[model samples]
Target chain A: MRAIVLAEGAPYAPAPLSASHPLPPPSPDTTLVTIHAAALNHRDVWIRKGLYPKIVPGSVLGSDCAGTDESGRRVLINPSVNWASDPRAPENPDIYGMLGLLPLPGTLAEQVRVPSRLVHPVPSHLDFVHAAALPLAGLTAYRAVVTRGEVKPGDKVLITGIGGGVAIFALQFARALGATVIVTSSDDSKIARAVKLGAAAGINYKNLDWRKAIGAHGPFDVVIDGAGGEGVAVYIKSMRPGGNLVVYGSTAGSEVPLQIPIVFLKNINIKGSTMGNEAEFKSMLELVSKHEIVPIVSSIVDGLERAEGAFDMMKNGNQFGKLVIRVHEKHHL
Target chain B: MRAIVLAEGAPYAPAPLSASHPLPPPSPDTTLVTIHAAALNHRDVWIRKGLYPKIVPGSVLGSDCAGTDESGRRVLINPSVNWASDPRAPENPDIYGMLGLLPLPGTLAEQVRVPSRLVHPVPSHLDFVHAAALPLAGLTAYRAVVTRGEVKPGDKVLITGIGGGVAIFALQFARALGATVIVTSSDDSKIARAVKLGAAAGINYKNLDWRKAIGAHGPFDVVIDGAGGEGVAVYIKSMRPGGNLVVYGSTAGSEVPLQIPIVFLKNINIKGSTMGNEAEFKSMLELVSKHEIVPIVSSIVDGLERAEGAFDMMKNGNQFGKLVIRVHEKHHL
Candidate 1:
């Protein structure tokens, strides 16, 4: 198997592309997957830089992929594992971790082995590049927007940092659910791009009064935010009483400054959500298939040799959608 | 009717024991209740000190009351109004405000007029004073512990500020639900009182390492918190993944400092809860009746003439239970 493994070095460069890797041993519960396309995520960037916890230097690095299984079934891998079917949380701690990290091999390879239960058929409308983009970000958005937020038709939904792959998916999913989506970003071009992608409104967080913009579009019904900082105060203020604030990541800062009284008085719910359970992954795929929702692939590099450029694009933080790697031609067996 | 009315003064003292006030006008949707007893809350103290919003001069100022209706029905008033049975939230904002404020008459009076729908039968186990304590605090606790927290049997529960009427109620309600209850208080004596009242364990928040004590009892499944500030960090840190931290008040500080990443990874739910709607109020009364739960009353003043003393005790915060005013004999009928 040719794989993308972390390279141990002084600077800790994640050379996620390796030509020499041993094929995984066969297991009764596991099946081999031949990856046709894989996508870059923030997790890949962190693992490559050796910033993620419990880093195994030789571990593969990727969480999202669209590929084929041994029985010749078209599939997409659910990177989140050990969650059982519990929507509330994983059955156990630590074991309910994502793929592409220690102990679990990643999908940025010609072949990978995974538990059979974590595999699902790819949405027929999507090609491998687009299908690769769906596994991680789409599942996250499904849980955050559809499951946690419970966004309804005509609901006003606000998603922050529209440049991230998850935020873009959230916009699409919320829109697919018939919600009026609003977006926030520091980049006006990204805001414009989000508007083109169906956002009802967009605001630049850099504004001295960025919060003022929210009042016009919504006292939003559901707010999907990953930027936790002083910025949260405005989200708290702008939400309707009993609104849900679903969070999956914290790219901006870890400390959230919240007005405690408002949360109590407004009946607000702030939930911490992450990569979802396997059931949610299937539901995510169902929604994607039913809506013919194509994964937003911002850029696709030709092969694993250009993996550095893809990872760099993710690291630089300006990409608006998923960055995919074409591992093989769609016709590959 | 003699009502406890707000005295229009510079240092606005709540004359919560008016000798003579006009009786509330009769209305088609309203029913008159002859007050036998009323309980003092932190809300009463805030209104008395003129610290609460929208104070109307000469308006009555109390929330929890147990009395007899015009039809001689033994009743307790649900102070939360206009919520229209939606367990999620009030159908509209502002109109869902509690009693004892402007536009709504308070319970601290010889007779109070309220919507007939907000009146319910008092639990047979409690006398007037205890029943008075049940309305506001018990409803808040029932919503926090039972509704939002959804505490199940064997769930470990944490209630902070056991001195508070609501927290005490939460402790009792969670225990009655077959949960193992833990309480936190700054006063050792209050912790002792909470233990006597059924807490499995108690920790004094005054201790510099208060959270360390929690490790022995649990990583709590549900934490009912009223005091929010830097202290919330420890509460968040000490909860299980998918734990519910229900906030109904912010007595310590309004700003809560949260570790956003932990919230997302642990899938913690931070929800703001207040007094429940009509349906939850009925359910609360049912639970109280079924369990024969008694409100922990600290002191019952002989009459409204000593209402100041009861209000002062609530403001000083050393009392371990509710301070109530006995307006009339328990057998007023």
Candidate 2:
């Protein structure tokens, strides 16, 4: 089986393509998936740079994928694995792992074995490439916006770092829920592009008083942000009283000064969300199917050999949406 | 009406007691209560020290009060006023006001006029002093523990600053909900008292590795905290996955280094909760009545003439519970 294997070297070492990786056999509770398309995420970049610990050399490296099973049914793999049975939270959150994150083999390989329950049929309207983009980022956005943020009809929603896959998905999900979506980005061009994608408004965070600049668009009912930094305090103030700030990442570095009085006095909720439970994953797919929401795929590479280019693009932070790898032809069986 | 008023001086200047203040007149929508007892809060102390802005001169400076109404019914007043209609949050949080803070007259006077809705019948089990202690601190604890934290049976709860009024109430409330309560305080004697009040365990946060000291008692399902400081980052790591850390104050200073990855990765929720809504207040009173919970009042001054002494006790951080001013005899009608 062909796979994108992490090279054996120091952090930031380039991973190379290999066609001689051994194929994983299906366990009794697991089924074989022939991946047609897979997508790159910040996780992959971080892993390549050795920022994420316990790097397993020669391990397959993609968390999001869309492919076919023995029954030739279109399915997208749920990357978040080993979640506890509880609906409210994972039973052992500390030990929870994702596919392609060390112990679990990712979807970059042409064939992978996974628990049968983790596979869900792709929306009929989406092709494998777009379907591949929806697993990790989509579920994350689903939990942040729809479940945690509780974006409702007529509610104003703000999503920070507008060009990232999760932020883009959050915008789409909030808009699909009939919310007025607003976005913020350092790049005005990306903000403009996001506005074209049904965002009600956009703000360039480069301005000293971006919060005041976007005052007319707020106070937002929900804010989906991944950046947890000193600036987050400003976002808290921008929210309506009792608004939800659903955070999933900290690209801007951790350690934010939180004005405690403002949070409690305003009845604001700062919910820390991540890759959701299986139920939320199903709901995300259902919403996608109902709305025919195609993930924003900014670039597509031809094969595993070009996977490094996708990773480099993500490292550069220039891509506006998901960067996908065409593992096989759509007609492959 | 006798009351305590902030004197014209620098921050931390002593406020003076006055017996010649005019009594508050009851409006059609308001009721006049003859105060039998009123408790001093950290808020009262802070305001008297000029830490709070816009301190109104000649204003009575107490928030928690228990007294008799025109009908001679025993009552306690909830000082949070003019909340938004929404049950989840206040309408305009920035402008939300509390009695005795500024602009609003407090309960330090012999008589106070408040909207009828803010008054609730005191449980028969409570004396006026104990009842007064329950209104402000009790409501804050109820909101933090029962409402925001969502503590459940068998859940392990952590309340920081165990000796404070809010912390003590949270300990009691969590225990009432069948939770295993743990506390953190600088004073070991306070920890001993908390354990006597049904706390499962206690940790002295003054120790550098307090997290390790309480490792066996955690990862807590809910952590009701009022102190937000550098130590909060460590507490975040101590929470179980999907645990709630309900924060109400920032006595340890407002800025804290929040490790964002730990928050999202653990799926921990840091909720900011303050005085609860009217519905939550009613529920709190019902719970108090059901459990026959008596607020812990550490000291009782003979009359409003010694109200400044109560404030001084709080400012000195020596009181373990509430400091009450006995305005009149408990049997006053």
Q: Which of the numbered candidates is closest to the native, going by highest lDDT?
A: 1
Off by over 4 Å in 1: A14-16, A329-333, B14-16, B329-333
Off by over 4 Å in 2: A12-15, A84-88, A208-211, A214-217, A329-333, B6-15, B84-87, B101-103, B329-333
Q: Report how far off residue A215 is in candidate 2 (Å).
A: 4.9
What value does the lDDT take at residue B18 in candidate 2?
73
TM-scores for chain B, in order? 0.95, 0.95
What TM-score number comes out for model 1? 0.97
**Predicted candidate 1 versus true structure: per-residue lDDT over B1-333, tens digit per residue:** 666788887544544566768888888988899999998888877776777767778778899899999899899999988887876789988666888887899988888899999998889888898999889889999999999999999999989989888999898899899999999888898889889988988898788777688766678899999988666888888899989999988878988778899999888999999998988989999999999999999889877778777777777788877888888653232
Residues A1-333 of candidate 1 have per-residue lDDT tens digits of 677788888445645567778887798998788899999898887776667778888888899898889898999899998987787788898677888987998887778889999988998999889999999898898999987898999999999999888999999999999999999999999999999989988999898778788776778999999888776888888999999999888888898778888898889999999889988998899999999998888999988878888877887888889999999653232
lDDT of 2 by residue, B1-333 (tens): 577776666766664777677777556888888898998888887776676767866667889999999899999988878773465687665666788865677888788888899989998899898999998889889988887899999998988988899999999999999999999999999999999999988899888878787676777888888888866876787788888989899888787767778888777788888887677788899999999998998999987767667776887896788888888753232
- Return the TM-score for candidate 2, rounded to 2 decimals: 0.94
- The number of clashing residue pairs in each candidate reads 2, 0
Which numbered prediction scores highest in TM-score against the true structure?
Answer: 1
